[model samples]
Target: MKKNMGNADRIIRVIIAAIIAALYYTNVITGTLGIVLLVLAGVFVLTSLISFCPLYAPFGIKTCPMKKG
Candidate 1:
Protein backbone atom coordinates (compact mmCIF):
# COMPACT_ATOMS: atom_id res chain seq x y z
CA MET A 1 0.00 0.00 0.00
CA LYS A 2 1.06 3.56 -0.60
CA LYS A 3 2.52 5.25 2.47
CA ASN A 4 -0.17 7.30 4.21
CA MET A 5 2.05 8.27 7.16
CA GLY A 6 4.75 10.91 7.02
CA ASN A 7 8.07 10.72 8.86
CA ALA A 8 6.77 12.87 11.71
CA ASP A 9 3.65 10.79 12.03
CA ARG A 10 5.64 7.60 12.18
CA ILE A 11 8.05 9.07 14.70
CA ILE A 12 5.25 10.25 16.92
CA ARG A 13 3.58 6.87 16.84
CA VAL A 14 6.83 5.21 17.77
CA ILE A 15 7.34 7.63 20.62
CA ILE A 16 3.86 6.98 21.94
CA ALA A 17 4.38 3.27 21.67
CA ALA A 18 7.66 3.56 23.56
CA ILE A 19 6.00 5.55 26.30
CA ILE A 20 3.28 2.95 26.67
CA ALA A 21 5.85 0.21 26.84
CA ALA A 22 7.79 2.08 29.47
CA LEU A 23 4.70 2.56 31.54
CA TYR A 24 3.80 -1.09 31.28
CA TYR A 25 7.30 -2.21 32.12
CA THR A 26 7.52 0.08 35.07
CA ASN A 27 4.24 -1.28 36.45
CA VAL A 28 2.63 2.11 36.15
CA ILE A 29 -0.04 0.39 34.07
CA THR A 30 -1.07 -3.18 34.80
CA GLY A 31 -3.76 -5.81 34.38
CA THR A 32 -6.34 -5.54 31.60
CA LEU A 33 -5.71 -1.89 30.95
CA GLY A 34 -2.01 -2.47 30.57
CA ILE A 35 -2.54 -5.43 28.28
CA VAL A 36 -4.92 -3.50 26.07
CA LEU A 37 -2.59 -0.51 25.86
CA LEU A 38 0.39 -2.77 25.16
CA VAL A 39 -1.48 -4.35 22.32
CA LEU A 40 -2.40 -0.94 20.94
CA ALA A 41 1.23 0.13 21.28
CA GLY A 42 2.31 -2.91 19.31
CA VAL A 43 -0.12 -1.97 16.57
CA PHE A 44 1.22 1.56 16.55
CA VAL A 45 4.79 0.32 16.12
CA LEU A 46 3.72 -2.02 13.35
CA THR A 47 1.90 0.74 11.47
CA SER A 48 4.77 3.14 11.99
CA LEU A 49 7.25 0.65 10.60
CA ILE A 50 5.08 0.06 7.55
CA SER A 51 4.16 3.74 7.23
CA PHE A 52 0.55 2.81 6.62
CA CYS A 53 -2.59 3.20 8.75
CA PRO A 54 -5.59 1.16 7.66
CA LEU A 55 -8.04 3.32 9.58
CA TYR A 56 -6.82 6.43 7.80
CA ALA A 57 -7.46 4.77 4.43
CA PRO A 58 -11.21 4.68 4.99
CA PHE A 59 -11.19 8.34 6.03
CA GLY A 60 -9.03 9.30 2.99
CA ILE A 61 -6.45 10.73 5.36
CA LYS A 62 -2.89 11.12 4.13
CA THR A 63 -0.15 12.44 6.35
CA CYS A 64 2.56 11.90 3.79
CA PRO A 65 3.45 14.95 1.77
CA MET A 66 2.59 15.01 -1.91
CA LYS A 67 5.34 14.20 -4.33
CA LYS A 68 6.38 17.18 -6.41
CA GLY A 69 6.14 16.68 -10.14
Candidate 2:
Protein backbone atom coordinates (compact mmCIF):
# COMPACT_ATOMS: atom_id res chain seq x y z
CA MET A 1 0.00 0.00 0.00
CA LYS A 2 1.11 3.58 -0.63
CA LYS A 3 2.21 5.64 2.32
CA ASN A 4 -0.62 7.89 3.48
CA MET A 5 0.93 9.01 6.73
CA GLY A 6 3.14 12.10 6.99
CA ASN A 7 6.28 12.43 9.07
CA ALA A 8 4.41 14.20 11.86
CA ASP A 9 1.72 11.52 11.95
CA ARG A 10 4.33 8.79 12.08
CA ILE A 11 6.17 10.57 14.89
CA ILE A 12 2.98 10.99 16.87
CA ARG A 13 2.19 7.30 16.58
CA VAL A 14 5.67 6.41 17.78
CA ILE A 15 5.32 8.74 20.74
CA ILE A 16 1.98 7.22 21.67
CA ALA A 17 3.41 3.74 21.36
CA ALA A 18 6.35 4.66 23.58
CA ILE A 19 4.03 6.09 26.21
CA ILE A 20 1.95 2.91 26.22
CA ALA A 21 5.05 0.79 26.61
CA ALA A 22 6.34 2.94 29.47
CA LEU A 23 3.04 2.78 31.30
CA TYR A 24 2.80 -0.95 30.89
CA TYR A 25 6.37 -1.57 32.02
CA THR A 26 6.04 0.75 34.98
CA ASN A 27 2.90 -1.10 36.10
CA VAL A 28 0.83 2.04 35.78
CA ILE A 29 -1.46 0.05 33.55
CA THR A 30 -2.11 -3.64 34.17
CA GLY A 31 -4.17 -6.65 33.20
CA THR A 32 -6.53 -6.81 30.23
CA LEU A 33 -6.60 -3.09 29.57
CA GLY A 34 -2.83 -2.88 29.54
CA ILE A 35 -2.51 -5.93 27.32
CA VAL A 36 -4.93 -4.44 24.82
CA LEU A 37 -3.15 -1.07 24.84
CA LEU A 38 0.20 -2.77 24.46
CA VAL A 39 -1.04 -4.61 21.41
CA LEU A 40 -2.32 -1.36 19.95
CA ALA A 41 1.05 0.23 20.67
CA GLY A 42 2.76 -2.57 18.78
CA VAL A 43 0.53 -1.84 15.81
CA PHE A 44 1.37 1.86 16.08
CA VAL A 45 5.07 1.14 16.01
CA LEU A 46 4.68 -1.17 13.06
CA THR A 47 2.64 1.34 11.08
CA SER A 48 4.98 4.19 11.96
CA LEU A 49 7.97 2.16 10.85
CA ILE A 50 6.29 1.51 7.53
CA SER A 51 4.83 5.05 7.25
CA PHE A 52 1.45 3.66 6.32
CA CYS A 53 -1.93 3.47 8.02
CA PRO A 54 -4.50 1.00 6.65
CA LEU A 55 -7.41 2.77 8.34
CA TYR A 56 -6.67 5.91 6.31
CA ALA A 57 -7.04 4.13 2.98
CA PRO A 58 -10.77 3.36 2.98
CA PHE A 59 -11.47 6.86 4.24
CA GLY A 60 -9.46 8.38 1.38
CA ILE A 61 -7.36 10.32 3.80
CA LYS A 62 -3.84 11.42 2.94
CA THR A 63 -1.72 13.14 5.53
CA CYS A 64 1.45 13.28 3.52
CA PRO A 65 2.05 16.47 1.62
CA MET A 66 1.89 16.36 -2.16
CA LYS A 67 4.98 17.01 -4.22
CA LYS A 68 5.21 20.47 -5.78
CA GLY A 69 4.99 20.65 -9.54
Candidate 2, 4-56: lDDT as tens digits = 99999999999999999999999999999999999999999999999889999
Candidate 2 root-mean-square deviation in Å: 0.7
Least well predicted 10-residue stretch by lDDT in candidate 2: 46-55
Model 2 TM: 0.96
* Backbone N/Cα/C clashes per model: 0, 0
lDDT of 1 by residue, 1-69 (tens): 999999999999999999999999999999999999999999999999999999999999999999999
Per-candidate RMSD, Å = 0.5, 0.7
List residue ranges in candidate 1 displaced over 4 A. Answer: none
lDDT of every predicted structure (CA atoms): 0.98, 0.96
